[model samples]
Target: MFVGAIEKVDQFTRPIHFIFRYYTGSDIVPGTATLFFVNEEGFAITCRHVARQILYANSIYENYLKFRGELRKFEKDPGFETQRTNLENKYKISAANPIRVLFNFIQCVSAYKAMTIHLHPTQDLAIIQFKEFESVQYQGYAQFLKDSRFAKQGRYLCRLGYPFPEFTNYQYNKVSGDIEWTKEGRSKTPSFPIDGIITRHIGEGSEITGIEMSTPGLRGQSGGPLFDPNGTIYGMQSATRHLHLGFDQVNREVVSDGQRRRVSNYPFLNVGQCVHVDVIKQFLREKKIKFYEQD
Candidate 1:
């Protein structure tokens, strides 16, 4: 039902591709997040968590650079190993800490010298503005649903995002001990669309702030657009809530591959939670950002 809507949404929806490495690991990990253009002036919307990571990337990398420089100064000393450990502790560079994080906006703008971010105080929403860009690369912008009252329960909606980290245009620079974007390998990942019925409205007090869907939102879909078959955006996918279904089996015997085996099972219902259109519109208006709306 949303084949055409996906095409329309894809025109403005873009992926933020990221590569990172842990402080104690040599492997580079790739990930993705989604965002959609709200205007022709290079303004886009995404999850606040996603924007936070982007905002912290510089500091994280710079901290690692400082640690590396300090370690190099002690490399020729007899107490090199001990000094290395001290440096790690001073920098709080644990094994799980990310030492490098690099991200690129995929097909959103021609080139941007800087990015301006506005984060909503209480909601998982954020705005990203590309600055000093030669041109906007996204084809169109989001048209939000005018009246969110029409987004009733049982209404089916589709969300679009880049959930799979299938792109490989990144590598770990062995010389610099950092992760960097490369010109080789695949540079793009495919956008996925999932459809589900609105199960309920989520709210604080009497004001509805979110839409809960019957299906779960994928990991990289956190900032994606939720729209109807008409291509009108209703919300932005924020997170997923897992409901414990209370169906648990302990040591149940089951036949598998013509053999009997004991198994234990527990199931949970995963559902998508989205930031509602009303909240999105309100935040945009508060920031004096331009956006489109349709009934």
Candidate 2:
């Protein structure tokens, strides 16, 4: 059970934050996210879903929205024609593809709709990169797993998150129920263990290319890093269900394209998934992060 770094300032940069959506509007209302550091050089790891919305926007829309059309205008409550920034004129994109005004990170980074990711498609794992690196204290993950030669059966794994906490940062106002809502598959811990077995060898060498020979995963804990008894890096969280959409569900129903009020529940699904450590090693190698390969 890793107690995530609480102090906002990492050795290189600031704490990570996120921008998510949930229980409030006609469409998905945006919400917040959190992240923590694993490297001394400011690099951190976080859930892909936590940053996907913003990334998908920039990667494609940045080019698609370059259209010429009437920009959507806004009014403050009843300030009908008072004033507004013409999104079309201001952002070079239009209704087909408009850029969001703001974005956030849950921890270790910020204002990024897309900069911190080197993601795996099916796995919930996401590798984030920073402009620079830092020298924060690492608990020597390499040694942790080495000590846990044979993963203890029925042992527990735990994770720490900022969900259901107020003032995630010292600069927050009195907000209620500010949650992370990221869906996780399995969990691990530094404080306590979760009940599960090693099952079998998902993979033997420096790759995680095997099936679940171990215990399964849980909800809201995706993208979490895994470990061996010595606490060395092994895997990260990735939660999935039959059909997945983990966020705050809006109680109010809104009519959709067909003109019927659709029902989408605020997700409370109990399941999650994770990416194997081999993928992570490849990511670091690609980024020149000097990764270790187990024998």
Best by lDDT, which number? 1
lDDT of 2: 0.41
| Worst window of 10 by summed lDDT in candidate 2 | 6-15
Clashes of each: 0, 65
Question: What is the lDDT, from 0 to 100, of the residue 169 in candidate 2?
Answer: 21
Candidate 2 per-residue C-alpha lDDT over 173-230 given as tens digits, one digit per residue, 9 for 90 to 100:
2263233333342221112123233444344466554223244454333444455333
Name the lDDT value of residue 167 in candidate 1. 90
lDDT of each: 0.94, 0.41
RMSD of each: 2.0, 11.8
Instruction: Report the C-alpha lDDT of model 1 over 61-166, residue by residue, as the tens digit.
Output: 8898899988999878999999999999999898987887888999999868988999999999999999999998889899999988899999989999999989
> What TM-score, computed on C-alpha atoms, does each candidate reach?
0.93, 0.48
Tell me model 1's lDDT, rounded to 2 decimals: 0.94
